[model samples]
Target chain A: MDLVNALVVFANFVLIPATAYGAQLALGALGVTLIYGILRFSNFAHGDTMAFGTMVTILCTWGLQALGVSFGPLPTALLALPIGIAATAALVLGTDRIVYRFYRRQKAQPTILVIVSLGVMFVMNGIVRLIIGVNDQNFSDGERFVITAREFKAATGLAEGLAIKTTQAVTVVAAIVVVAALFWFLQRTRTGKSMRAFSDNEDLALLSGINPDRVVQITWILAAALAAIAGVLYGLDKSFKPFTYFQLLLPIFAAAIVGGLGSPLGAIAGGFIIAFSEVFVTYAWKKVLGYALPDAWAPDTLVQLLSTDYKFAVSFTILIVVLLFMPTGLFRGKS
Target chain B: MNMRNLMLFAGVAILFVLTGILQSWNLSLSILNMALLSAIMALGVNIQWGYAGLFNTGVMGFTALGGLAVVLVAAQPVPEAWRAGGPGVLLALLVGAGVLAAAIALHKRMPRGRMRTITLLVVLTGGFFLFRALFDPNAEAIEAVNPATSGYMGGLGLPSLWAWPVGGVLAAAAAWGIGKTALGLRSDYLAIATLGIAEIIISVLKNEDWLARGVKNVISLPRPWPVPYEVDLQQDPRFLQVAAEWGFDPVTGSSILVKLLYGGLFVAVLLALIWLSERALNAPWGRMMRAIRDNEVAASAMGKDVTGRHLQVFVIGSAVIGIAGAMMTSMDTQLIPGTYNPLRFTFLVWVMVIVGGSGNNWGAVLGGLLVGWLWLIVESLGPIVMSGVTASMADGPLKAHLVDSAQHMRLLTLGIVLLLVLRFSPRGLIPEK
Candidate 1:
């Protein structure tokens, strides 16, 4: 075994997992940033929103699976994704109309909106739990791998083997496609520019004859789509659990804040940054290092700085440290 | 303030009576005591939010510390277990402290940018392992004493009553630390920072099995009131006469007697704190705090240090929450760390404060009492609501299924109630002007 062989093995496992995770996080962060920009407060319900979306997707996937509707070498959830996104978007828009619109009319403070989001979070959580119970549901269905680890090792005749799963590749491709769509929607469209103009200066935009309600509506649709996409990706990668999705709220918020809240690109960059750092810092490098190092120099310990269980701590620590240094975040968020 | 106080007092009195009529007296009294504690907590929140307009979202952390205080000060000591591995544990603790100190010192001494980051990171990494090596072994020895019963070092063996005050102090110290770091930042920053710190505190409590026993839980904690042993007095002829006079069964009479005794003690503490806090809020310092909150820039321009005033109030308010925390642990007679989730203790408390008038102490107290009663009843009535709804439906498979699902309606109800309140009245029943 040599360094090059170890690198190949590392790429197959850790890098692939991290990249898939980073893309999912970036999607989640983009949703959060959109809400913070337009609504003007962190949406505590984002996690539950993801759960609600995933719950629909899972149900649809199950229905499709029972009907024998599935793509070969890909999850049946792929067919159910659009249905999930549409349903989720409708639910969110409805919630905005009933719960948030009243307070918006009262001209309530943003903090009040933040508190209202907590209430929404609880409701959404209950709804998801009510429908799916709290148990984790593994709905993944795809080819196990492009090449099994055993086959790869046998074929390469190397000590380190490689296996690339179909789901992982699909996750990365879907993320890139969705992100591209979102960027195109936001940058190349008239409504997208109007939304940005509104978030940047609402008073000026209103004076500029841009319809406030129209801009706000478009923002929610975009946010809901992003959230649904992110939720589906996360549920695909990990199993779908309502509480776990809620727990993801902290990290999602961390990514948004780290990237600079209100900046879509910043959210994406921040998500990847948080995901990669968390994976890297907590990972034990012993296996890869053992293959690379000289026989005498190989160490016994894991050689990790932090434990994997402290992933939340890593995100929070990075957030606090970054906030201490740069309050505006990486991309310098909107005024 | 007087009109608000009168209205609040009337509201609480009515709530107490309504709860007694609707539910049982025992449940009402239980909620009453908690309401009083919630009032204290709200007062703490009011000091920060009402006086200084500073939001401290880490109420759960300081409250948990108060629970820890009960364990530290009131729980009986396990002398044998302490003797076996207590010194080792002590040494491990010292090592842990040394690690933190070294991390801070390294941060200061190292040059800026990459050098500082690298130095701090290296020290932290090394320190983590060194302390873990020391702690894990000692913890194993201590836990080996009696893994099923009393496996670790116990408390100070003081009266349980002392735990309440000690909780306040611990909470205050925690508040001081958090405030020093976060109070100077913007409000939103403070919110996120506080949220992060609260999670960290909960994580520590959940994982530190040696201290809180993590999910294992500590139970049967002693209290400062009369013991149930007094129930045996009913066998006496004289006690029988008393029970007859009360026109109740011996068991009912004795339980109620004990509960009333606890109630009196709790009420006294609650009232004393309320009165003291009220006085403080009306004093010159209180007026200055209000002034600072209204216009921080103007306050600072006029030579009043708004930040410092905010810190002072933040610490005091958090300490009050700590007192409530100790009271809760004592009442439950258990320190179950896993139960301290954000939704229950933290967000619920936020709802109480916001719904209670944010700036008014009386409003807080009233809101606490009303909400606490509502919380208890909501849990009980949630199932009933579901049953009634489902019962009216046609007797089919769907009806049977919905009835079974009724068991999980409380969470939905709670969420709906919160949304309704936020929509109709964000300032609570009485707006704190």
Candidate 2:
């Protein structure tokens, strides 16, 4: 019983939250990795892109709410997600045409592209702020929890109880479906193979008659979809704020680089690793320890590896270590 | 000067004069002061990206380090707080460093295997706990010591002037650590690494209440130059007489004089930096840096230590930025770590550098002045433009939204300006020779 209780506590604090967070980060990292793999430049504006998409989703969610639309026991954001993704896809494609195409034609270095992305980041950030002022917007409306702690406690008759949020369940389910579909698309499709080929060797792919423009467009569309879904999920789990999304860039980039920037599998693995580390390190383990240890031997203080405020530091430390030891990342990326 | 460069300077001068005539001398001088500082920041970026091709996206972090220098060098020490935990905190940090050094030595001596990894982890885990054991209590005690005013362990109580070079040194030290790890990587990797470190630095600044009081903020840092209070100046008959002779009101005269003092100090520093920058750019060292930047593999093939040169330039560039940051802290008379947002402090400086011309010092200066002027002007004029567009609209949410949206056009303008410059004059208004 004690063991079960302890496990439940651990699940409540560390396992469940980390899994939800990991799914969100994994989705975000996938978008970043896809772009880096194909475009051959780190999109610093990726976070702002996420923010812009999430903003669109939030606005649409509100519009739907006003129109008396609702998703039973789930966030109405799910219903609005497709429209958000489409809008974001158009925006990204337009940006590529207007700004990035010029640099691509010039045969500019990747660093120049990265700087141009910074410009795009600013523009996107400005647009997001203009549309939705820089404040926390809580738009997640519906059933709050899939399994309330009270319900769990009543069922289990344990000292500790686990609560699963509706958003958390939706995030996991949605992520699995999206990731599975993405994998299927990448593995089973000719266009996907061409994208992989183009990423592998651009010159060879070009000579082999791969439509570079189509691959680029497809990559942007997929990235925008992933970014939009990830952003909306994250905002539902937490709250929508433009600046927080911008701050998410570090962890997202960290996950991509840690996973191997150009490798899809590596990004997913890296995201989970980062999410788990951040959650586990910052979690105060006194309650679980108290349940596990003999009464006198139980720790008095919260045995946290670091404070929660140092969450970014956790990802950063991991990123630095990964970069130092394995520049190509966990999987062999472009070294 | 070249004709293009001369014209750019003339344009900046005219903008400042217009600001003075249209607005007030105080506002004009204020903008000039910030522009001068922005120019310094731009110059620092020019050294890295312009010379050595290092994408340092951590300008805000280095600037924050400079702010930390101001707090450390100038703020009055809290004796009671120090007494509570100062030695213990110092010893814990030393022990933390020692533990890491020992772990590194152990890892190096041992074979690369599981045993080494286990030993290293053991040492690190033990050290972390031991370090925490010493650190937490002292931190709590220190924080508890007069929590309202000076709960944190304070600084050296030295004059503000000492902070400028100290800030440079501190930021240089941080840059050295970052560059040592990151400079060998690709440009994008360096950008990511720098950005991560910067965010980590900011998180530390925000969370570590013991250091610079964190979000509580340390205000009214001592200034070196004379800052005449307008009321005090007005009370002085000799000051009134001087103001009368100068055909200036006492209030405006005092404010203008104070700004002029800052302007004079800022110019002195800017001129010194420019002189040094020009000398270095003309030197063979500068040529090697440019060569390394243009083609790293070729430079390496020529037996140049590419990473070493990159590190050197990175350090120098960060040091210059740190100096500017320290100067900015002094100008504001406070150190608010919360205000050091990467968007405002880091990316804006990059815009200045890129728009000015990456490789040219004069271009950087011009870009800084021009961009800074535009930043302020757009911010002031955005509402008017928005209102004009909304003139046909009814008084409602849409109109209100448009007005608010105008306020955000500064960022939009910044992006458009940057993209346009990159497209039209990729080399900048004053192309590098």
Candidate 3:
């Protein structure tokens, strides 16, 4: 009956979820944008590569769990994540050298590279499935919540309780830290500038005496590391399943495209836009509406803009609209 | 193109003969038919990538749509279910069409810029609500009647094979729509768009349970061929006689017969498509497509309608894939939406296209059969290959380890095959002119 209490609950549930989701998409979009910049193709396998990286981390998490190691306040998966990043970095570098190198040398079309990545996608998918059967595996081994709903209600003395799960907090923090590091590395580091230079113009970069192989190697490593972090964080926030990663392709790609394909900052912005839109648009704001507006003004209907299931549809529609209006993405790629 | 062509045909025949010797004639024949369908699909890809040099990562979506065509055109209808879903869907479609038309008209008629965009958003959003409001009740009623099996509108009561051409038509139509807008963009744009379209198609198929039974799956679909529900092959003397001659059982003989029937149908379609593709390749149109593909700017300067030609090839190629999907659906006598995954239909088809040779129809056909057979045989073959390699593990748990490893070899083999092919012969087994 209390309007203020309802509004608070709404913010805690809807806004926080959207914010956390936005963080995940932003990180994932950064990974995708990085690869598209240097690799010159939209990798169809990026999602699964993320999955593969997470699977490695999950394995390590289980091993640590078996060894009775605990992060206490944090999920042990957090502890295992760096190791996963290293392993994923190795795998991505190997793929670049072994599979992608030949095509790069031949100067094959970007479309051809995309198809080749599809092949790599299938192989990676099969391997990931083989390693962890096609089922959702939870590896978060920390306390359930930063504040349980009961605890929140008792402290606030309000009808609405704000319960933040440990995993969500970790996901948000990790994403911010990783993204901050990525931007710093991309802008300030020698190798990072080299990647930007190459993405801007290959011939010019080569003329400037930048090593192409070195740039590519660095790009792959960075992309892999980003993918690993994104995958681990998303898996931690939700749950990790091979198929979920495959399905996550839509949202991740949506973020990348909306941000403009080659721009990292754009990718981050695009990801938040998409994630928030998907969350807010599908969110049943009836509860919040009841509180926000006076009794006469409160809507009788669910007032949800779209069903939750149509979340992907919204993302896709946004992408299509953006592509139609601005093919270079919302923020045009750096000239 | 003469002697070598004949030798290639003879080489294929010899391969078939080897299949005859090693596997059952029926099993070999059955695989041949599926392989033929795969080839047809690959040829569709070839026309786009090889001739027009356009990329389409949504082959699976088009194929599934083709399967939908077959179901719509052929399967027997349940009148109640039909009436329930049919009218509601028609209404939904009309409203959707109206919305799209209004959006487009607004785009044209209104002052260009934000005003037009706002008009579109308002109209589209209103239409979506209107469509959903009208759709929900009818869908609920129809689904309620037949909760499990016949949840949606039944198909037109006709021969399911009619679905093949219809599937082609449907796929081509979608291609035209997508290619017209997206094909003009860069390769990466096209890939992303196509991939999105594919996912949308899948989502529709999955959620629109009233249409293709959604994720629940439509099993025991009416087959163009016989279902063989008659006398168990064990009791059939004719099958026994054939089995004895072939060093097989009556059951095997029957399977072979059905497989051969399927194989013949698939090959006929494959040959026809291959012939059509080759003819197109040789035609002036094909040369222009190539010209446009190789250098868009040059071709455009030369007054070639590069985008138009690309749209044509993309549509035609997708139509072929759709037809092939219809054929596969017919072969299985089932339309399982869940079964037709992107990794298989979409990505695998791309592999077939790339490995075969992008522009070469023959290369695509060869690659399809090669990969198709490899995909099927690798499971059994992996163990044998591993057994020979792991003979040194006699003292350890190495044999079991090798066998376990073999289970995962199929994907590894697919990956290795693609990598090796791209590195060595990027053009494929049969390079086009």
Candidate 4:
């Protein structure tokens, strides 16, 4: 019973929240990795792109709420996700046409493209701020929690209660479904095969009559969709703030690079690795330790490795270690 | 200078003159001072990116370190706080550094095996607990020493100008550590690493209350020598008589005099940097750096230590940025960690560098002045521009929102400017010859 109580406490704080955060990071990493794979440039604008998509989803969610639309037991954001994806796709496609296409034609260096994306990031950031002022916007409306702590305690008859947030559950489910569909599309579809070919060898793919433009377009659309879903889910789990999304760039980039920049499987693994490290290092293990250990052995301190404010440092340390040891990352997608 | 460059500088001068004529002399002088600092920041970036092709997104971190230096070197010491926990805090820091050094030495000396891993873990865990035990209590005590005002151990109370070079050294040390790790990696990896380091530095500044009072801020720092306070100048009879002879109010004259002094100091620093930069660019070392940047493979084949050069340039550039940051903080007479946002400190400087011309020091200075002017002007003009655009529109939330959000237009306008320059004039206004 004591062990079970410890498990409950661990799950409540470390496991569940990390899993939800990991899923959001995985989706975000997948988008970043895909862009790195196909575009051959690190998109500095990716975080702002996520903010733009989330802003659109939030606006649409507000509009739907006004129209008396509701998704019972789930966020109205889920219903608004498709519109967000579509709008994001349109925006990205337009951006590519206007800004990135010229660079592609020039065959500019990747570093140059990165700087160009910084310009795009600025514009997108400004637009988002203009549309939705820089403040926390709470959009999760339908249900707050899947299992309340009090209900969990009553059911389990334990001192420690395990509460699962509705957004967390939805995030994990949505992430799994999205990942599965993405893998299926990439593995089984013809267009996806063409994209793979292009990413593998651009000249060879062109020689074999794979349309470069189409592959680039489809990549942008898929990436935009992924970013939109990830952004909306993240906003639902936490509060939506433009600056926070910008800050998320570090962790997202860490995950993508740690997973191997162009590898999807690596991105998912890297996301979980970063998310778990951040959560575990910051979590105070005192409650769980108190439950698991005998009274005499139990510690009095918080037992946290680092303060929660140092969360970025956790990801950064992990990123540096990975870079030092494995420059090509775990899955060895590309250097 | 060439005709085009001369014309560009002339144009920037005209803008400043126009600001003074149209607005107030105080505003123009303040903008000029800021522009001078921005130019220094841009020059630092140009050294790295233009000379070495290293992408350092951690400019904010270096700048903040400079601000921290000003506090640590110039602010009055909090004797009470030091009495409470100063020695303990120093001992803890030394222990922490010793532990890290020991771990690194162990990693190097010990063979890779399970036993080694176990030993390393034991040492680290024990060290961490030891560190926490020493750190937490001492930090708490330090913070408890009159929490309202002087809760943290303060500086040496040196002249504030000393903080400028100290800031440079502080930033250089940090850059050395970062560059040592990230310089040899993939180009984008360096960018990401720098970006992460910057965020971490900021978080440290925001949370570490025992250092610079964190978010509570450190205000009323002493001014550097040779720049008199406006209040003092106003009280001086000689200054009042001079003001009267010049047909100006003493208050206005005093303020203008103070700004002019600041502007003179800034100009001296900017000119020195440009001269040094020009001399270096003309040297053989500059040629080698450019050669390395243009083709690292060829340069490495020629036996150049590419990574070492990159690290060197990175350190040098960061030191310059640190100096500029310290200067800005001193000018502001306060150190607010919260205000060091990346948009203003990091990317905007990048815009200045890129728009000025990457390989040219003069271009950077011009870019800094022009963009700095535009950034401030946009803020002032945003509402006016929006109101003018919405004058024909009906009174509604949409109009109100647009007018209210006009300040954000600077970002959009900056983006447009960057994109336009990259597209049409990728070399920028003062392209490298």
lDDT of 3 at B47: 82
For DockQ, candidate 2 versus 3, the one ahead is: 2
TM-score, every prediction: 0.90, 0.98, 0.92, 0.98
Which stretches of candidate 1 lie above 4 Å from their native place? A1-13, A102-107, A144-148, A157-166, A281-309, B1-15, B18-23, B80-85, B98-118, B225-241, B392-401, B404-408
Compared with the true structure, the alpha-carbon lDDT of candidate 4 equals 0.92
Q: Candidate 1 residues B1-433, lDDT tens each?
A: 6776677778778877887788777777777777777767777777677667877778888889999888888777888778877888889889888988888787777778987888788887788888778877788777777778877678888888889999999999988877776677666667677777777777777766667566677787887755444447667678779888878788766666666777787778778877887788789988888888877788899899987888898888888889989988987789988787776677667767777777777667777777776776666676677778777688887776565555445567667877887666766777765
Which candidate number would show the highest DockQ if scored against the true structure? 4
State in Å the error of residue B51, model 1: 2.8
Candidate that beats the other on lDDT, 2 or 3, i.e. the better one: 2
- Relative to the true structure, candidate 2 reaches a TM of 0.98
Query: If both were scored by TM-score, which would come out higher, candidate 1 or candidate 2?
Result: 2
Summarize candidate 4's per-residue lDDT along A1-335 as a digit string, tens digits: 27999999999999999999999999999999999999999998989899999999999999999999999989999999899999999999999999999999999999999999999999999999999988999999998899999999999788878899999999999999999999999999999999888888899999999989999999999999999999999999998999999999999999998999999999999999999999999999999999999989999988988889999999999899889878889999789
| TM-score, cand. 4 | 0.98
Q: Per-residue CA lDDT of candidate 3, range B1-433, in tens?
A: 5566457646766776777678657656766776678888888888888887778888988988888887787777778876666788778879878989888888888898887778788998899888887777677667766777788777887877788999999899888878876777777777777777877777777787777778787776776744453246667777777779879666666776667767777877888887888787788987888889889999999999877888888899899989998888888877877777776787677778777777877778877887766665565467888887887677566566556667566765677677677778887766665
Stretches of candidate 3 off by over 4 Å are A1-6, A290-309, B1-20, B225-251, B380-407
Clashes of each: 0, 0, 3, 0
lDDT of each: 0.80, 0.91, 0.81, 0.92
Question: Best by lDDT, which number?
Answer: 4
Q: Mind sharing the TM-score for model 1? A: 0.90
